[model samples]
Target: MQDHIVVLTGAGISAESGLSTFRDNGGLWEQHSVYDVATPEAFARNQELVLRFYNDRRRQLASAQPNRAHQLLAELEQRYRVTVVTQNVDDLHERGGASNVIHLHGELTKARSSKYPELVYDIGYRDINPGDTCDRGAQLRPHIVWFGEEVPMLDKAAEVVRTADHLLIVGTSLQVYPAAGLVYEVDRDVPITVIDPGEPASVSRARFIRKGAVEGVAEWVAHYL
Candidate 1:
């Protein structure tokens, strides 16, 4: 059997594809505080603003091409069992040819029913208007794991991490809760590598490559693949 290689990615990886990171503008996105546009309360108070924010993000994602870092990880599948667990909402990893991916923060290209989380649809960069309704006649919301909302995929991600023969964390600072805690799930004996320009405090035992995603991943591929 091919050795399982679990990869944990964040906004840093997608940033190379021209997508902006969440904390780029001093904890603001598009001049709005995260709480103003990325929380369940924000959606409840002003659905129009919240929808508009995600609509813009969807358009940005549509224009972004997967960068070399994303492609390198996909190429690793030829020799290893690769599974990507990404905090990014964009589809760059999939576009880069990764067949197996778990979106921890939800997907920008999809929408879910306000009433039923299971009722999701692929909207694919289409603007979600205020009145856009789901199949059950409820308003459709961005399928994002907004602040104050439980992450539905957290358990599955931990399980995936536990099975990793090797773990690679790219482009994340490991500051976010739940997701940051995943690195602890790997067995102590498993090899861990962290590739990012900034140091992630959580993974002290990991071999750190202090470089941007594209450069860092390239260095990793040269040594491993």
Candidate 2:
């Protein structure tokens, strides 16, 4: 049986593909504070503004392409049992050919019924208007797990991390809660590698490759693949 290789990725990997990071522009996303557009309260205060914000992001994602780092991880599936656990809402990993991925933060390509979270619909890159409703006649909202919301996939992600024979962390600062804590779930004996341009806190024992995702992943591939 092939060794299980679990990869944890973040916004920094997608930043190379021209997507904006959450911390960019003085913590403002597209000139709007995260509190103004990324919370359920914000959505309640101004549904149109929230909808427009995500619509813009969806349009941007439509133009973005998967970078080399995404491709490299997918390529690793040929030799290892690869499972990607990503904090990013983008679909680049899937588009790059990764067969198994767990989106910790939800997806931009889908919408869920505000009244029934289980009623999710795949909407592709299309803009969701104020009147968009699910079959149950409830307002449709972005499938994204907004700030102040629970990360439903956290437990499953931890389970995957615990089974990893090899753990790779790329492009995250390891500053976010729940997701950051996942690194500790891997067995102490498992080989761990972190690829990022900046120093991510909390994983002192993991081998560090201080380069951007594309370059760092390439280096890891050369050594391990």
Residue-pair clashes per prediction, in order, are: 0, 0
TM-score of each model, paired residue for residue: 0.97, 0.97
Worst 10 residues of 1 by lDDT: 22-31
Q: Write the per-residue lDDT of candidate 2 for residues 1-225, one digit (tens) a residue.
A: 999999999988999998988875543466897888999999999999999989999999999999999999999989999999999999999999999999999999999998899999999999999989999999999999999999999999999999999999999999998899999999989999999998688586799999999999999999996
The per-residue C-alpha lDDT of model 1 at residue 184 equals: 94
Clashing pairs in 1: none
Candidate 1 C-alpha lDDT tens digits along 1-225: 999999999989988898878775543465787888989889999999999988988998889999999999999999999999999999999999999999999999999999999999999989999899998899999999998889999999999999999999999989998999999999999999999988677575789999999999999989986
- Displacement of residue 42 (Cα, Å) in model 2 is 0.6
- TM-score, prediction 2: 0.97
Q: C-alpha displacement of 141 in model 1, angstroms?
A: 0.4
lDDT of 2 at 34: 80
Best by lDDT: 2
- The models' CA-based lDDT, in order, is 0.92, 0.94
TM for candidate 1 is: 0.97
